[model samples]
Target: MKILAPVSSLSEALPLIESGARELYCGLSPAAWGKEHGDNIWLNRRGPGKANLADLEELEDIVTLAHRKETRVFLTMNQPGYVKAFYPDLVSFVRDTLSIGVDALIMADPGLIKRVKEKEPAAVIHVSSLAAVLNSSSIAFFRSLGAQRIIFPRYLDLRVLRKMIEASEGDLEFEAFVLNDGCVFEEGFCHVSHAFGGAFCHNPAWSYKLREISSGGNKVSQVPAGGESFQQNVDEYKRWLWLGIKNFGGFPGPGGYPLGMCGLCALPELQALGIVSLKIVGREASLRKKAAGVKLVRKTLDLLEAGCSESELRERAGELKGVPGLCRSGYMCYYR
Candidate 1:
């Protein structure tokens, strides 16, 4: 499986390319979209700032640089929905990217996919994980619709993944996350609003408010219905659950991005299953860490390719990355 790393700017392009990221993907926000929508509202998932490319030139430079290395680039326009008024501009965006020689567009919306496909009929399309494609027929349906790839959902189990791969019958490419951030909500199906940016779910304020209500159980231990608390729970978990997620390990450390989450141990299995691209998840990751993440993924892929045994792969993952005992269990692994 090739490494499909994320890039948000021209500065990140070369270092990642050199680190063995053969296919780089990112979200792009053009000047026109930002001007009308305002800078705060992103065209897709990542909320502005450094998470997406600022304009056409940076995108062009990234596309140009990656192409010079013979590395393919895919752009994300994977918003769940766009208003009727957005289509003409969306088509313009697709055409502009096609002009830049973008290899593919990764998006969840079929309507937007149709818009792009109409403009550049030969342009490769990748079904984003946000599409929540859970079945063989669904993938087949996408394949029939001109989608060349599927970014497999983050929480899918190994058995289901194997079944999906079996169903595909070598007709499509699959991209699975191997390292870093994953969604707390099941990625594809969650039509999450980007309230106070896309990091809304990561907001500690939600948990803190519930904590004041003295809520600390898998169920609602505290009732604030008539009070000032705004408590929302999920998977039958209480408010501390987010804190548990943040400081997830039985071991102590910061819970989120800086701490490594890995599926390197499953790489051998994934490759055997014909997954074409194993993704390193963060698009907004720091430049140095992006390079490191790619290098680390490169090492894992190399070790797997060099006939490393599964046990050894796990150990080597710990040695190179994938901090042992933190998210080492199946719940944290992408394929498991």
Candidate 2:
């Protein structure tokens, strides 16, 4: 199983490739786009300026360094809304960036796909998780548009993913998340905004704040967001607390440290099934974390290839995870 990782900066390129990242993906927010959309309103799924490389020149340097190590680089254009009005400039940017020697364009927007096809027909398009591809037909739809690979959504279980692979029958390249943060809802379907300037999902303070507000700050929270009554709210709070204690490795605080999600335990199974890539999520993750994640995945893949049992892989993965130990719940796993 090959490891595909998200690169945030030029410095990460060599270290990540050295750490065992054979494939890398990143987002670039040109100066012009940043000026207009500000920081939060990103073209891709992540927040601009924070999760992206701003200068194409620097991106080119990183790409070149990665290529020297035989690592292929993909650029994510996973914007949900890039309207026709933005086409001319958008096409210009894409065309220029493609000229910088990117290996593929990972995206979710059909309009952007169409535009990329029109401008750079030879482009290899990989559908992003934002596309929420749940089955073979959805894979076929993107395949028809020249998408060669599909990063299946986070919600898919092992049963369904295996079914999808069987249904595809060697027609598509399948990538799955191996490690890092996870979400509480379907990424493509969630209407809830994540910070940027609102009551977003990333903010863990919501749990406590909602509890207090639900009770009108009287210490008895009423109608716990989705549930009814103070007890139900209290139960929900306890559940979150329990989840924090179980999931977020070392950073077991209220925020859960990027919401405390992981899929390291699934690596042995995924590798057994011959998964094309195991992705480590975190475009804005720190350099140490980036290298450590890649190293962990690399070590696990090596252990698996050497015929390590699932139980053994699980133990090593927990050691790497470093906190909120064990894979006791499907909620914390990336592909349980």
Candidate 3:
């Protein structure tokens, strides 16, 4: 299994590369968050603490660094519809990034996928997990458009995932989220955008809303829907969830809302089954933590490859625990 870590900063890049991360994924700037950041960088105004033109240059530096180590850099264009609708300028952003020649672009929107392919046919496109690709039809649609990989929706259990893999028949590479949080919504079915006037920023559908509510010294926003907040611009919402926000962790899976990080130590057993990538979440994670995560996954893969006893692997997995988020169990479908 190959390990892909999320890189929020150039600082996070090197250590993850050294620790055996085969790929890294992240947004270009605050616009990537859409309306969540609320600073209008997507509207072309300056966003506070946002990645700038300089940041893209720095990303080139990171890409150069990763290339030296033979690692891939996956840029996220995964915000459900938040970035594209709100930041139309993003068309150029996509063009520019592909021009820079990073490994692949992870995308969720079909229109965006069309646009990206139209402009940069040479750019590798990976279906973002936000696309909620639960069926083979969805898989075939992306394959027709030349998607190189699809990040399997986390809501899929091992059985459904296995079937999807079989159905793809090796036409598309499959990537799975092995660590960090996941949502309950069918990847593309989230309604937060429509509900919030694109202000709340979850899915690009324009069905979500954000009410400004006060919480302690700072104001906090909530996604009554799912996945919008986490996928949008800004960084690391998990810290707040870990601090006891019930909305993120109260659910058991990705049905109503999102749940927290999934621990997939059990996933290594699937390697022979043909999953291409084992992905970690949150590009915003600190350098040390991301690097540590990379090392942990690499070790896990090595042990699994050696045919190390499952008992031994289980012992190692005991060190890492899974957390629950707001996704209530039993609700299997996104809209129902």
lDDT of each: 0.74, 0.73, 0.62
Candidate 1 residue-wise lDDT, 28-68, digit = tens: 77777878878666687877767889887888889889999
Q: Relative to the unseen true structure, what is the C-alpha lDDT of residue 329 in candidate 1, on a scale of 0 to 100? A: 41
Weakest 10 consecutive residues of candidate 1 by summed lDDT: 249-258
Model 2, 207-238: lDDT tens digits are: 44333443554665444466476656656555
Could you tell me the TM-score of candidate 3? 0.68
Candidate 3: segments with Cα more than 4 A from true spot: 30-54, 82-88, 184-187, 191-260, 320-336
How many clashes does the backbone of model 3 have?
A: 32
RMSD of 1: 6.3
Would you give me the overall lDDT of model 3? Answer: 0.62
Question: Between prediction 2 and prediction 3, which has the larger TM-score?
Answer: 2
Clashing residue pair totals per candidate (backbone < 3 A): 0, 2, 32
Once all C-alphas are superposed, what RMSD does model 3 give against the true structure? 11.3
Order by lDDT, highest first: 1, 2, 3
TM-score preference between candidates 1 and 3, better one: 1
